[model samples]
Target: MSPPMIIAGIVVWFTAGSLLSWHARKNLGEGMIEYFLADRKVGGFISAMTYSATTYSAFMMVGLVGLTYSSGIGSLGFEMTYLAATVILMVIFAPRYWAAGRIFRLVTPSELLARRYRSPMAGAVSAVLCLVMLVPYASVQLMGIGYLLEVLSGGAIPFTVGMLIAAGVSFVFSWWAGLRSVALTDALQAVVMLVASLLLLGFITLALFPGGLPEALGSRQDLLKVSWTFPMFLGLTLPWAFFAVTNPQVVQRLYIPSSVKNLRKMILGFSAFGFVYTVLCVVFGLAAAVKIPGLEKADNAMAMLLSSVPSPLALVVSLSITAAAVSTMNSIILTLSSMFGRDVVRTFLPDISERTELGICRLLIPVITVVCFFFARMQLGLIAVLSSMASGGLLMQLPTILGAFFWKKATAAGAVSSMIAGGLAVSFMYVQGLKPLGHWPPVWGILVSGTVFIAVSLATRPPIDTEDFFSSLEGYIRDSFGS
Candidate 1:
């Protein structure tokens, strides 16, 4: 794609997104709940689309496609496992989260922990941990767009410019109308991403196999097999399997559906969208392996495949990838801003007015975007490595999050101690290049944290209101979802 053509594509995408964001602002109301959760009024389709967009990101097309291209069917198994596990986790936790959010007026996931554990420190700790892990992950979205633009424009568009554009778009949507704008734009982006992927796959298929779609992917036979060893598969899938609860951005989403029926629709719709997108990404990778052989870096597989495509079609696909990045980034920024305002800021300034809280959140959106923009500009490491570390680091939170909903014995001390221990272990392993017994860092983090959480909770007294909390939560869930 030529420089002007790439620029035009970006212009069109940004304009469409801006218009959607402007339209969504009409639904926005006053206060933090309205700003952060779309006033808890998002419909099923938009909820599902936002959730899918927030959860998947450019990782699906760029990172996952690269993984599939390099590692074969293992990538498919890894992602499908995540999808299946997410559905199960959501089924168990979404109703509880929604009930809690409504009953408690919770704006952030961390706030739920704080309230359940009766400790503001728990919310603050979780918020800090989320920021530490997710900022790098958010940076990867910017980096993905940077790389995509550079590749598609033949370096006529520099990486920094791409990062700036992505950050700018995300900031505009997230700052304009908060979650309302972000969710609406996400729905549009999700459609573009899915349609573009389908179109790209069709073109690649027609170009490569003029006769018909092949029963067997030609060449790279080894690439078609499950190459990930048992430990590798477990290590990779463990953290991702629990992503719904572990990642605050998606977890916060559990609180956004307007009704029980909408929540059900959100889960089912995301499941279908995820299944199709995952399959398309895997197929695209396999096709790339066959059509563009001998790529030194597997991460370049998508770029190489795009090079073979017609310029206009390639631009469309590239814009789709950009949309994926922007959709995810905006959601992350919105969620993080909410956490900063509700969980962190309000902890110290509990008396702050709702207007001030809303202002703080709006201000933090651009600040977070700028931080991610700089990180993307630095190009610290492989996008996949940083992204994986973020997921692995977040896995530490699963024990506390799940225990908050189900276990009466779960204590604040337990949650805090376990998170610190698990986070340190994951960080040390990542920093020192340690993977004991061929297990991933996330595996170790989960094991250590689960043990620590149980031991500490057992050693400590349960919160005084634990019984009441559980009883009320259970009653609400039963009343709301009839489960």
Candidate 2:
């Protein structure tokens, strides 16, 4: 991976992404909905791909492998659990969400909260938490881009420079095209990532492991099994089970379906795709661990494995890695900006025109780009740590969001308190050096927050107009079904 080749590969990716952005802006009409949600026009296939790409992000490439390297086989639980959770969301939540967004013309998940709960304050809270969680999560993607560049270029490009270039291009593409641009680019990137994954897997298996992956695995069988004791399993799975329900990025995906039929198709398709992709990633990590033993940390597994391959092959893998980061970063930046402009600013300054709102969203790209660049330079090992930390805090939103759409008895106060208590408890544990008795803090956070939410909602007065929430959502379902 010479400097010129590395630069050229990136230049090609950004150029293609830019072209797609231009096309999106031209066709999608620069409205906030178009920018953020692709005007709810995405069909089954693209939606599934977008969901998988966003969910996988750079973490699967870098962090999953790193985990497989350090923890052995237990990391497979992450993907298996994610697959289970996603399937449930598709079955129970996606159809309803698409309907809700279609009826309300939601630009952000917070806007959905506002409409459902009929409280500007609730919308504001949702918006704040989304922005807070997403920016850092997006930044983690940028950090992966930096890392990919650093590894491929053999340290010729500084990590900061690499992150800036990658995030800068992502921010620009997202700002220009909005949802259309992100979707189109994501579709293309997803293909690239798929090819890259398969090719790299083959290369590593045949080229590196002469006896093949199964043989290599025999030596490190311990790394391939589930590491979770019963308690650990509960801590990890329970919180993550709630994550797909509440995660803004994950739930925001529910808003993009063109029809209910399409939503069903995506659920099945994405569940299969996500399961395969995650399983392959874990396998790659485990194989890498076998090839490159004694890893001090899990996150470095991918990079360490790449170092063993030929430079040119490593470069291809690196490009796929870049695609992983860029694809997710673009989506996150677009979502965060939309949330900021629509959920936070538009509340107090409703007079701000839609055109102005779009402009504000575009302006935020650069601001977020800089922040992500700074974090990319930090010693943020693998992206999984950053993702887990953010996901843990935001996991508190799960029960409340579910209650809003499904539980009629859920009150606004209870929803608000649940989010506050859950988010705070997770943050507190992190700050206080609290660890989940050999598990993650998010596990406890989920339990504590979830219990409070259920108790409070049950104990409190019912929402003033629970029927309004369902009534508003009916139009969406009808429209989706009809369409």
lDDT of 2 by residue, 96-183 (tens): 7777776677777778777777777778787787776667788777777776787777899988888878877787777776777777
Work out candidate 1's RMSD over C-alphas: 1.3
Clashing pairs in 2: 35-179, 66-298, 66-299, 72-223, 73-223, 73-224
In candidate 1, stretches whose alpha carbon ends up further than 4 angstroms from where it belongs are 213-218, 382-386
Backbone clashes, each candidate? 0, 6
Any runs in candidate 2 off by more than 4 Å, and if so which? 378-387, 436-439, 458-460, 471-483
Please, what is the TM-score per model? 0.98, 0.92
Backbone clash tally (model 2): 6
Give one digit per residue, the lDDT tens place, for model 1 in 368-451: 999999877877665446666888998999899978987888999999999999999998888777899999899998899999
Q: What's model 2's overall lDDT?
A: 0.76
What TM-score does prediction 1 earn?
Answer: 0.98
lDDT values, one for every candidate? 0.89, 0.76
| TM-score result, candidate 2 | 0.92
